[model samples]
Target chain A: MNALPAHVDIREVGPRDGFQNEPETISTAAKIDLINRLARTGLRRIEVASFVRPDVIPQLSDGVEVLQGIDVPDDVSLMVLVPNSKGLDNALRIRETFSEVAIFVSASETHNKRNVNRTIAESMADNEIIAKRIVAEDLRCAAVIATSYGCPFEGTVPLRHTLDIAEQFAAAGAVEIGFGDTTGMANPAYVGEFFTAALERLPGVEVTAHFHNTRGQGLANAYAALQVGCTSFESSFGELGGCPVPAGSTGNIASEDLISMFHEMGVATGVDLDAVIDAARAAQTVLGRKLTSHSIIAGPIDWSPTADAPSCR
Target chain B: MNALPAHVDIREVGPRDGFQNEPETISTAAKIDLINRLARTGLRRIEVASFVRPDVIPQLSDGVEVLQGIDVPDDVSLMVLVPNSKGLDNALRIRETFSEVAIFVSASETHNKRNVNRTIAESMADNEIIAKRIVAEDLRCAAVIATSYGCPFEGTVPLRHTLDIAEQFAAAGAVEIGFGDTTGMANPAYVGEFFTAALERLPGVEVTAHFHNTRGQGLANAYAALQVGCTSFESSFGELGGCPVPAGSTGNIASEDLISMFHEMGVATGVDLDAVIDAARAAQTVLGRKLTSHSIIAGPIDWSPTADAPSCR
Candidate 1:
């Protein structure tokens, strides 16, 4: 019942986060093609690839090639993920090519250690230095606090811990911050309160909400954040990047699904729903499997007055 | 954010709506088993079967047998769908078994013609007589106004038209009315506004929201209804009853998915989460296929502090 936002910013993470979790390796050219198609869909921001260790995540091994091969429009911002200083070094090598680079650390100590083999303090120290370097280099940077909503190992993360980390990231010269529901444990009530607290704690900062559809609350949580005045969001095309541990869990919220919801609610996202579905279809073909996206599966609600009646399934 | 309702009434319609949509017909015993499991899951109201023409919905041809087979508890109310006078006659044979009977008509004339070979006016005329009969028989009656949100054939149903239909149903001695998103076209904004108007116009009527997950807005729309103080909802276990007219379209909001969302937000449904999931699993086994409910697949989000971290899918 809150007044909805007039518009929202959608950041496509399919090319990077979506492809990285696939069991099969994606070619640089295929990744470039997907990203290029996505860019044309009126998505102004797309995370192209991650600069993680190739041995660790071979799916996104060709990060540099993907960034260089894709022909992004001037208006679209190409983002690359940087894990630590080494990843930052790789990103900085082609600093001018990417519009921004993101560094991530888990809110839970266990998840951070399991994900990156580093303690929270150690990751923070690395991020502080890397974030400062990226700011100094004049490139846009964001500190992504993963598992900001709830952690698999740690459960309900202390609100203080997440906010404290955001403050540190802001202090380290990070212009933007991202709170991730890395495991898809966020609820709408929690999301509304969390983002409200986040925005109040760090004013004048571009905060992004990244949610997964693992538990099917991704879009619901996104709406809650939007109600609380968090305008930017991160999602994947075709609902890619499904979590492996929870065998049947889905990945990020589909870009088309989120856009469709916003567009239906009279909230502008400046993204083409049909075009995003095209990209999602393209991704599905590349993967040789079906992806989990409701909008893509069920096309936009036909508003034509004389259309054929729907059948009873 | 709006304050969610403190409690919600969940009407489990899987035994009727869900199974009727499946291409394969389930055995009468299997239907009884699934219904029995659901009845024990703390679902106070369960739509056990539909008394439609056997030729039309052959999967639910065992309606009478299923009604006679299941052992419902004292606290549970067993509901059955009756299509016409004949269906009601069949239900009246064992009126003592069913606590309530629901008669349905589509908001769109085209859908009504296709679904039951009658115009909205003809159906309404029939419903008025049938509703009075059911009330006289000491059974609660509900007029299910299908496609109350948007008609697949007509599209964008006027709010005035829907409320007018609700007014008619309430005037016909129908104690309860259900507004169905037959093709999953209802948006949260429209839903909130629609329900607000429905309650105001039809004061003291037990209004229920019935949604399909065709475009994945079922739960989201349910949440919107909740925000507007509509606490009663109808969902199917394992998200059964998928729409066949729309290719690749999903079914109703999974009972577990809606319950999971409400439970997470500190709302009470009185139904056991794990028990509902168990019934969903049992339904999946009976159907011999995977279901669309996220809770059935992902299990509940583990809040244990020392639980194993989720894997990357």
Candidate 2:
């Protein structure tokens, strides 16, 4: 097997992606508190909130308020998701407050159209304009290709199709591109080959691999991507954010879970695992529910045989 | 990364290990029914029961009855776990009934003493004698070195200790050796390196990788083992068995989850995914509780977009 990367960048997406799909509406104060706690956990990049239509995602309607509330560490790059010109305008109004803004379009037309009520072409056009504006505003712009691995509506997205969209995003001057397995449909072999091809094709652009634990292959897929040299990852705290349509689909691979795996493998993710677990615990409290994160449930494997048993209650 | 193996041998251990850890005792008939269903799922080797003391693991107290009750297929090899000479004697009473009997010792002395109330040296001696007796009876003998990666009691076992046990097992005429992460403390890098070294040292022995999902790296570790060419795996149906001492530790990597991963990677395991799911579903029915198996919950990612939505409920 190939050697694993020495270090990986873990992009926290819980505040936005996770809360957006939560059944209960988390208060803006709770969201800000979680984001601030996450920032303290050595997470350098955090997708704090999404500036989508309030009616569509009422959970994140307080995006601007959340952005205004949190005290982001100077070293942390706070990112927010923007859907169109309106969202971008909202983000640009406070462009100096955040470090990065991301725009997304699903890899398959069906999913893109369904998600954003816009065709992939129209979304890309909007992204092109948004990407330029964000870059011009001195913020790092990221174009996330959602459902890049496989589409819920269109299974097994062709590699070429995703690459074509990525090429467009790259040309649009997006500095980073994230490929999201929006519905957790990616397998290890596919992840390995896809990331290998993606990095090879999109040289110099920061390539991030995003996976969900829906089928429980999230960490496995992350390992595959790591083996193929994709160093950036996006995960949610407490394993929040499943596919809305597929009601019970699991959330993004738990940020703490992914960090635990990397930390155990001696891969430096910069994110503090203990702190991440604390954040996850706080999230469970805030969400008023138990979380799916393995680390939060099981704790990091106590490597000290002489230590007291982990209280697994 | 190296190419995954073309085929893998999945040894089903749910009947023995899984039941032993369950809170309630499964009826003999129910156990037999599940075993029969699992046999139909293309699993060649199934550990049907363990001949441990009934009081110690009341859930699997029906070992003898289960062994006599189930219908054995012509192609399937029924295996059972035997802890000592007494357990081996009990298994030997039905010697013709099983194809294989396994003895186990923990890699770490603390864990070994804690788990079996015996030192590693004593367990090894006992295994050597039991292995000879089993081989004398023309039955395959397997030595399981538990906590080969890290022990809950004596964390991070040395590679030499596990290798020594494996060598002793091979020297004792045992044909297969399984390295178990009893506490789910193994990471992928360690798994790859350990298995790679194991296969090298024990050149002709069938090396098996067993993992628990306690910290959720089970499938990832399996992937690592596969990368290093260990093609045999031991897993539980419905993710049934966990470290009994560690109150909330999860069961062995769910058999269905591991099978799903291998199948998705195009590595054939001969196990029928649908049949395995059916068996898992049936297990949940018999257990009267929700299972931890990922594929059981989410179903396999349907590759055909036109397929009907999975009834996740």
Candidate 3:
């Protein structure tokens, strides 16, 4: 087995990616409260909201309110997802609210067209401009390539297609690039190969692994990413966030579960596991339903001598 | 990343390990039906019953009936769990029904005592006798070491303790040794190190990984075991089989979920993915509740060109 990195960074995306996919409208107050709670859980980065059109993702229509209402420490960097030029413009209006902006495009043409009603070339063109403008504004610009592993419509996506987009993002001055397994089609071996090539291709840019637990390979894929020395990650609290377009593609790897695995493996994440679990429980309460996070249900492993005796089989 | 094995063997333990843990009494007919279905799913080994006292695990009391009722092909091997000399005697009454018998002890003294009302030495003494007896009768004998990773009561069980137990099982004529994460306390890094050493120490005996998904690290731990060239695994269908004594120690790694990861990683398990999934769905229906296996919920990734287009984020 390969040696995993000593430390890793995790960015909580549940507030934005998770809430936007929900059918029920999360109140602006609830969203703000959750984001505020997450910020204090030792997470240095949290995606607070998405600046997409209000009519498109009504669940996240209160992005402005969520951004304005969240309070965090100086060390915490707030990020908001920007869909296009218009979304970037809206986010810029509340420039003081967040420290970073993320722009996304699908690696597959069919997914790109369905997501943003544009060809891959068109989305890339728009995102290049958006990335440059965000950098010019002196804010951190991050690029996310969705369906980087495989596309629901396209099946297996060529590896070069994703790397090409990342290269463009790096050329456009994006500080970080996130490769997303949008439909959880990624396997560990493929993840290992992808990150090995990605790290070599993008010298100074941060490569983030964003995986979904749709097929239950989320943590396994993340482990592969760590094995290849890619340290940055993006996850949702309580396994929130699913591609609403796909029927079974639900669940970003739960933040607590990911943290639990990292901590147990002796990798430092600098996040409070119990605190994040509490925040997930809070999200569960607000949603009025059980969430899919295992840590939220199991809690962290109790290592104390007085821990309960397990039933022997 | 380390190279994983090209081919692996999986033993379905849902009927014995999973059903015994359930609170509700699954009918004998349901168990037989499920076992028969699993036998046809390309799984060569199936643990169909346990010879523990009926009062202790009334759910699996009809062990004899199930073994007699299940119809399997020539290649299918039936296994039974035996607790002590008494349990082995009972299993021997219908010895022809199963080809294999498994005896177990915990690496931690507290867990072993709580589980079987015996110290580690006593259980080992009894199991040594049982293993020799089984082999002498022209049957295969396997050994399972519970709390092989960490003990809920003692916490951080020494790796040497588990390896020593495996050594004993090997000396006593056991053909295989299974390291069980009885409380879901195993992590990937530790798993890698443990399996690496186990394979070196036990050259001829098969090393198996039996993980619980209590902390959502089941698949990740299994991945580590694979990286170290440990090829055999024991998993329950529908993520069944949990420690009944420990709160929140529920869910063995689901067979379908583990198989899904393996198939996606290009590892062949010989089991039909869809057939195992159908069996898991059947378990869910019989149990009258949704099971925790992710593959059962998502199904295997549909690779057909006519597969449904996923929703765009």
Report candidate 3's fraction of native contacts. Answer: 0.63
Off by over 4 Å in 2: A307-313, B307-313
Please state the Cα-based DockQ of model 1 relative to the true two-chain complex. Answer: 0.63
Cα deviation of A170 in candidate 3 (Å)? 0.6
Considering the two chains of model 2, state its CAPRI-style docking category: medium
In terms of lDDT, the poorest run of 10 residues in model 2 chain B is B304-313
Q: List model 3 lDDT by residue over B1-313, tens digit each.
A: 5577999999999999899888799998899899999999999999999998988889989999998898899899999999988998999999889999999999999988888989999999988998999999999999999999998889889888789999999999998999998888998889999999999999999999998888677898889899889999999988888663345445689999999999998899999999999999999999998888888878898665443565557
Interface RMSD of 2: 4.1
Error of 1 at A223 (Å): 1.5
**Predicted model with the maximum lDDT:** 3
TM-score of model number 2: 0.97
lDDT string for model 2 (A1-313, tens) is 6778899999999888888888789988889889899999999999988888898889999988999889977999999989889998888787777888898888988887777778999989988998999888888989899889887777889998999999999999998999988777888988888988999999889999988887778899999899889999999988888563356657589898898899999999887788999999999998788777778878776776475554210
Clashing pairs in 3: A245-B311, A246-B311
Q: Give the TM-score of candidate 1.
A: 0.97
Off by over 4 Å in 1: B311-313
TM-score per model over all chains:
0.97, 0.97, 0.98
Mark the 10 consecutive residues where model 2 chain A has the least summed lDDT.
A304-313
Per residue, candidate 1 scores C-alpha lDDT tens digits across A54-143 of 888888888888777889789999888888889988888888789788988888888888888889999999899998898899888888
The prediction achieving the highest DockQ against the true structure is 1
In candidate 3 the C-alpha lDDT for residue A80 amounts to 90
